[model samples]
Target: MIPEPDPALARSLADDLAAAGYTGARLRALWGVAADEAIGRGRALPARREAAATDSAVAILARLFFLGSPVRESEASAALTNVTIDGAERLGLVRMSSGSVTPSVMIRPQAYVDEHGAGEWWIASDIDESVRPGPLPEDHVLGVGGASLTLAGLQLPTSAARVLDLGSGCGIQSLRARRDSPDVTATDISEAALRFTRLNAQLNAVDGIRTLRGSLFDPVQGEVFDRIVSNPPFVITPRGADVPAYEYRDGGLTGDALVCHIVMGAGVHLVPGGIAQLLGNWEYVDGEDGLHRVRDWIAASPVPLDAWVIERDRMDPIAYAELWIRDGGTVPGTDEFETMLAAWLDDFEARGVREVGFGYILLRRRTEGSPALLRFERVEGAIGPNAALGMHLAESLRAHDRQARLSDAELAEAVLLVAGDVTEARHYLPGAEDPSVIELRQGGGFGRTLAVDPALAALVGASDGDLPVGRLIAAIAELLEVDPDALLSDLLPRVRGLLDDGFLTFAGGEASPSA
Candidate 1:
């Protein structure tokens, strides 16, 4: 079990870590980039080999905290001047036995960048599969992983009065949310997880994050926040199969019911116009689409909500079963692995589950009558490198609200500028003077590609902020010999779409999307 966090010790440890230059980038350079990447996939031998020849303070800390290897007591004492090796043991960060210090928890540097800026935090959590020789304990507290980082990046960069970090495993999301909001409430069912959240917050010297121990919304009942961000334990696991239900990924409930509960119950705790962003998994039953099921969940809400759900990935039942089984430290071709796979398959068959969809969900409580935004789509392709969806989502939400209030004539009178990241791609048949296909591609923000006709292409190419949209449409219609009114009627809605998707923006609002 992790010890209760003492603020004085945490501050000392933070100071020592900073002095030793313990950061993600520095560790990656110490080992080759390939070895660093390998550690993320639960293979630590490469990094272990690379660290064997080094005895620097950073290298020693990397071996103990990152690779989960024991370090000599003398070396650790020399490195941790402020925290001291004795204080570290007292804080339950390590165990000293036979002149060696064995790390009971892992503290590694996490680097992040957002609209505000770039910074690093030292995150502490339970030791991982590299150190444990067998299956993970059912109540393990996980460190920062790919899913955690994805949800962290998805958080909107706007400021808020209060924010909720549901299922705050290691307080990564809490730390990220604290960047925008002054007050953050982090809740989890596991006490160990909540302890890590408190420890992490104090370690980073970030204040105003309070921890509560309860399941889902129970701890935050009757409270309304401006934003709620969660990477919930929504992984579908079978019940009564004797399968290990890890607390970090499994929500104890069967199938996707936990996510359903979240969607159906979010409205009562959200103020009008409040937004909640989360990552979840939904099941696609026999001949039924998962997105449609999510739509149904939204419809069942006691209060109306605006939803924009994106399904980033999907996998069949067998593949999903194998993927999760391997995650619990079970090797393929082992008897235990086969047993667990069979249990998962049997459970899925009972529900008529055909596939599972994983993705991001953004929901907003409608301040007034009826919802305005209802977008459900699949963006399963690769996006541009370092895409900043948080900024894009915030901008798109504003654009949607702006366009919804405007009449067709008012929109046409507004000056517009094409986004800087957009480019035109034309395809032609051999020996043809005119192009057969025209496509506008977005380099960021969902990486959308739209096919356009000659008139639309000409209008976009000429959107240089000098003319009103109406005038540009009139000029393009004249060039194409089409009726001006007819062109306006056809392009008005499409232009609205472009504005909503960040392809085009109102003249003075043309800030480039972040990398």
Candidate 2:
């Protein structure tokens, strides 16, 4: 048997690992390689370390890289016997177990460090072992994953004095917030998760991250926040009354319970002019509007809040069942797999869940008493991730409120200025004698095109916002010698469409009559 690990020795090893290029990107790469090898080889364990000299940093990484492959606890212990697994455990480098000893070791990457090179090691072993209990080994670390990064990038840029991260798994979102905010308090249901959050905060060299252990806002009662963020465990599962310890994925409530609670409770916790960002899923009940459901939650809150809810993607009941069933590592063609799938479908159908909608939800507390709901949906583009769009949406909502308070007469007096590089084009029909098409084109970003109706085109060209839209239509009819009523009927709808599409907005200095 290997000798018991010493705490001092483990600290030394951790310091050395930190000195080497073992943290952040390097650690992620190593973990990725190890995961790939395990998945490809189907091996429960890899080769033991050969008692070679650890002179070169690359040599050590190579040894650890090979040793990191998913395996039985005994196999990993035997392989890295010289490294003192217990010592590494004490230093938060590896999580080891003797029972069922294949390889229960989980290596954590250091949280902070800028560059990727030798002697900048930042990886750490995952410490939240009690939260998730299972044989599947890859779900160990609290490293930055896709969903964590997604929610992080989606946060508004304004700095807050106090920020709250609810259900802060692994504390990734809290770390991001602490980079800008003065204080961050992260809450979770698991004590072990809180410990990991504290460790992760230290690893990132970020200070003042307080960890609270409780479900949602229990620990933060009577406290209001400047901003709140949560990537809650909103997955809908069939294990009614028998919730698993998978606190990271199971919210313990059935059919959008967690999301409703978060949405309803966020307003109470947000101070005036505060904001909250959340990523969650809501089940689709037949004939019910998911957007309206969220709207009602906002309406019920005492705090007046503005909300932007986007439904990114929807999955049908069968598709949803299959996807999550496979996620549990159950291979199809097996009895266990079929039974789990049946249970999922049955649960979904019994609850009348036709589909499930997933996306990002952003809420901001209005100043004192101006509550409004703005709901829109956009299919994610293929170009890149939609994280940046969330901030843009927030900015737009802020601008919209400013625009809404303007009076119609003030809107008429406003100059209709266009964005940079906007150009007008006239395309005439071939030889048939009709006038050419007058189109407005914006040459940047999505390159939006607007085809102007001939009569409306004349009105826009002459618009200094000096005349009301109805008078402008009348003036155009007189100038072109057309029927005034006929022109008004044709131009109104087209002009409204242009305004709706963002081709027109009031210019600065155009004060509303009400103002």
Candidate 3:
């Protein structure tokens, strides 16, 4: 059932939770580190046991909501004096029978630290597989999982007038986007998921978020916004009777058509100069590169866009099928598991699917007559746990926009400075003084590292916020007894890349501090 929560009771419950110090940090502290980690691995025994030992408000809420363990009605009433058991029932959060209360939905505290600051929100969603009585229903609303948190941190830090969150499941991205945007529109295909979004908004006391019911871009037709953020339903699933098509992940399209549709929709829905960021997966079929396929999709866009797409990880057809099959709560040795696996294999074989690529995508609508920047790369690694990358990305876009207008002669006159987080690493063979390899590594942003030749290394070493880049290049050429013009020609293109990547910043014209 799609819950229609009461705002009044939600407010009262929020106050009660605040009074009890119910939050992610407090819960993890209540149960030691091992117990917390074990909970994530689908075992709630430690947490249930630890929380059951106490009758404190935090414990009471945790046992009822997180662990879904039954709690005495009298104890719950005492813990939430403001919103007693009756009030909770009115809010559609719990059920009462035989002097005990059981949770209908899981209401957990999710802590977030982004460009704005650190804060917590109460999220209501369907109980996880670990706590559920059986396999989830088709339309299960998910909580703050890893993918949800990732797109949250990627939201731009700058303020916006309006933002659109497509496929806004549980409203996590919308909540995060609301930090910097005054107006937010969250859309979804499932009314159940939209109910969860409304429930979370009320729990967090966040206003100005309007809920709409529709598929991707359907609700916001003919509307333009300054920014759009989406953690869409991009997971790959087979459209077979044996395989479950969960609403939270699958988009009900054959192959990777759903992801392609979302990418193409950005062209019409976004205003000129507006940005749209989403997470998606692309297919690698026989003799076709997944990244190239994305480039083709961008080319087909009705509007011009500057795109920066990163593929973080890839999985073969068998591995991908097994991972998602396990996610559907089917154990490997079961008959149902064998049936689903066979269906997945049949689907992959029909499509000639070789691999699947998953990652982040950012697209900005471009103005007419302006050159659009298109970057497609693969970076397979780990980012900070909850690091806010929006600030770094904004700076990079600004740098690229500024440098695109400068010519070689103009750029030569610009002063350059190495970024503060940049460091140089040198490696030499045993018993050798001259280094065989030199690398420039960034300590922030995407954590990029680049190799450098001797002349480029000398130039970067000399960029200490003083002198023009051309002057430094000429000095390096003179030191190496090479033609200054040839050296300048060879290094200026690389310098442009360095500037765009945030390894170096222009210290001239309007970009300078003194200017």
Candidate 4:
């Protein structure tokens, strides 16, 4: 078991790291760019060689902690000026014997940019595959990975009364949430994971984070939060003695049941107007669509919720089995890999699961009346895992609420502006004066593209802040020789879609002329 965290030692370590210039950019400069990138791919030899060449405090510390390599006790003692080797050992950061100090945990600098601006935090978590090079123990705590950064980037940037970070592994989401909310509660089933959360909070000098030990929402029953962010242990795994369920990814549930449990329980713990953002997976059973299944989950919520779910990728059962089997450090040709693959396939076959869909889920408990938004879309594109999309999401939600309240006639009278990130592209045939296809492309926020007809494209092009929607359509109708009512009827619903997708926005007021 990991030792309980000590705040004084964490503070000292933080100061020593800061003084040593131990930052992501600085470390990347210490090693070449290729070596830094190689470390991310679990090949640390290049970085190890680079660290061996330098005797600086940062290099010595990196060798001991970041690379999980043994270091001479004298060098470690000299490197860690504030938190000495004894303090580090007591804090469960390292173990010392025979004039050598070996790392028990890794403290790496993580850099992030969000709506609150850019900053760096030192994240301390258990040693990863890069250092350990084997199948992880079931209780292994995870450091920052792709999924962690995804949920962290997806967290709403707006202020909140309180936030709950369910399944906070290395406390990355908790740290990110604390930037906006004054209070954050990070919960995990493993006590060791909670200790890391507490230690990381102290190391980063970020307060107002309370760590609890429990599975799912057991630690926060009957309590309501303004926001909830989670990258949960939603990985589907077979239930048997032969199969290993890593606590970091698998929630010990069958075939996306864990995601369902969290979705159903979220509505109960969210305050009215509260939002819950989480990454999840859902199984497509036999012929049932996965997105529709998620829609049903929202419909079955005790408290009606506004839901927006985007399925980013889908994998067949075979692909899914291989992906997770390899994630457990099993090579493709190995006997254990084949056994686990067979077990995973058998489980999927038993459940009639044909495919699994992975995506982002945003749920909002309604403040009053029934839910208004229920969008489940399969977005296809290469979106950056750590893109700062919270600002776009918040703006889109506000636009949705505004347009949802407006009647068609009222919306027609509202002045609108095409978003700055939106662009128009026209494709013409050879020797043709008129374009055959007109596409409106979004530079951000899902990077959506829409093909528009000439009338709609003309209306969009003419949507300056000076004129209201009704007038713009009228002018376009005059130029195109179409009936004004016919054009308005054709354009109103598309305008609403543009608003919801953030292609356009109200100039200032919901139904007022732009000033």
What TM-score would each prediction reach against the true structure? Answer: 0.97, 0.70, 0.97, 0.97
Model 4 per-residue lDDT tens digits across residues 354-450: 9999999999998775328888899998875554478778878888888888899999999999889889999999999999999999888888999
Off by over 4 Å in 1: 369-371, 510-515
Model 4: residues with Cα > 4 Å off, grouped in runs: 384-386, 509-515
Candidate order by lDDT, highest to lowest?
1, 4, 3, 2
Candidate that beats the other on lDDT, 1 or 4, i.e. the better one: 1
Give the local distance difference test score of model 2.
0.61
Per-residue alpha-carbon lDDT of candidate 2 for residues 99-129, written as tens digits (9 for 90 to 100): 4222333444423211121222232334322
In candidate 1, position 443 carries an lDDT of 89
lDDT preference between candidates 2 and 3, better one: 3
Predicted candidate 3 versus true structure: per-residue lDDT over 171-254, tens digit per residue: 998898888988999999999888888888998999989999998888988999888898888988889789888999999999
| Candidate 3 Cα outliers beyond 4 Å, as residue runs | 508-515
> Which regions of candidate 2 deviate over 4 angstroms?
1-18, 23-67, 70-87, 95-142, 241-245, 369-371, 376-380, 412-515
| Residue 237, model 4: Cα distance from true site in angstroms | 0.6
lDDT of 1 by residue, 1-515 (tens): 78888899989998888888999888999999899778877789999888867888888898888889899999899888999998898788999999999999999898899998999999999898866677888888999988999888888998888999999999999999999999999999999999999999988999999999999999988999889999999999999756998999999998999999999888778878889999999999999999999999999999998899999999999999999887788889989999999999999999999999999999999876432889899986887548998888988888777777789999999898899999999999999999999999998888999999998898899899999999999998888888999999999999989988999888876333211
